[model samples]
Target: MTAARANTGIRRAPVQRRSRERVQRILDAASELIVEDGLTALSTRTIAERARVPVASLYQYFADKDEILLALVKRDTAEMDAAVDAAVGALSTVSVRTMVAATMRAFLTIYHQRPAFVVIWWRGRSNQVVYDFCRAHNKRIAADLFAFAQAMGMAQDGTVQGVVELAVEVGDRVFQLAFEHDLRGDELVIAEGIELVIGYLERHATPAGIAGVSVQGQDGPA
Candidate 1:
């Protein structure tokens, strides 16, 4: 190939990186705005202003408002997924109680770490795109937990629905407590929530189980 031809075929690395960063900036601004004022207040114009990019440029990256919101949901969920995956990996072997506590802690940490994102995610806005993505993403996360429960032989019915339900219970309550009540001051609330979940799981979990299954430390003894 001629030098010009070779150059044309090669990707311009910086351009791609810059494009991604710009898109991220827009998404970040949208998330922050929606969290502060709710989805009804989110608009491309507002996002552009907050991101300091032209409104037209926001469209260049996202086709419309729905796309932007969907992107924000996916971004927040991906971060939570990564953290949960890391915590799960660390448990190489664990008891039902420990697994339950760890799962609850990982999830609570995700929201606690980004309370705004959690608020936006659960805001139940009227955007169908955001609604659908959140539904699917939640199923995927639950599926992962289900698979883990099965692999560890903790699911009595060979189905993870029970563990998944318990985890969601812990998550929903904690989310409410954190955002709706100002329970952030009451660290015991987080611990107690974990205990409630661990109690349910332990009643059903078999002891011929993985390592670290037994509860320990401040969060356990369930």
Candidate 2:
């Protein structure tokens, strides 16, 4: 009877810990593989081997390679969305120049956050699922940029239609460049791009004064 007193509260078995570890291992291996070989290089068997797990176990956690890729893309997209949201929040009570700078910082932040994925995105041969998602994401950003420019009174191309189209193009290119190339920490490069865009917007908005965001190269007389 005294020996029967030994007891303990409920506790998760070690199997649960091992299962979680396996899942994490799979994700880590997949991420490394992706960085080394790009998005097109992923496969369930390959990931299983890299993760040192049974191939069947990989399927236990993920339905397929596409599912894993989808998860990664979703994480990256969420990060970009959050970055832009924060940038816009900072501009809620700031000047246009400040907002522009914040926007540039946000773009660069997202660009450099996942260099490998960005490289894959720039390679231009990703799966259609990823490509379609990217197109939709860019469309949203372009619309936001257009609205922001108009709200700031800095986007006028003699008509709303013209400015809207130009804004969309400019917004797309700005982000595309930020992620497609090595421009991180290069303030001059980033500033020059921002200045070029601002100059275009200013020229269209007001024909009288020099309304561009002044930069080192473009400040000199024409």
Give candidates' CA RMSD values in order.
8.8, 12.9
| Candidate 1 C-alpha lDDT tens digits along 7-125 | 22212222677777888788778878866787677788999999999987776766566666666666667777777766766664567665666666776677766655665555554
Provide the global lDDT of candidate 2 against the true structure: 0.58
Q: Kindly report which residue stretches of model 1 are placed more than 4 angstroms away from their true locations once superposed.
A: 1-15, 157-166, 181-188, 209-222
- Candidate 1 versus the native: TM-score? 0.75
For model 2, how does the per-residue alpha-carbon lDDT over 1-222 read when each residue is reduced to its tens digit? 111111100111125888878876876687778777766667889999999999987777676666566555666667777876676564424333454566657767876766545654555434566566666666666566556555544555554645545654575566556545452534555677777665565555532222333222221111
Which lDDT values do the candidates have, in the order given? 0.62, 0.58
Which candidate number would show the highest TM-score if scored against the true structure?
1
Clashing pairs in 2: none
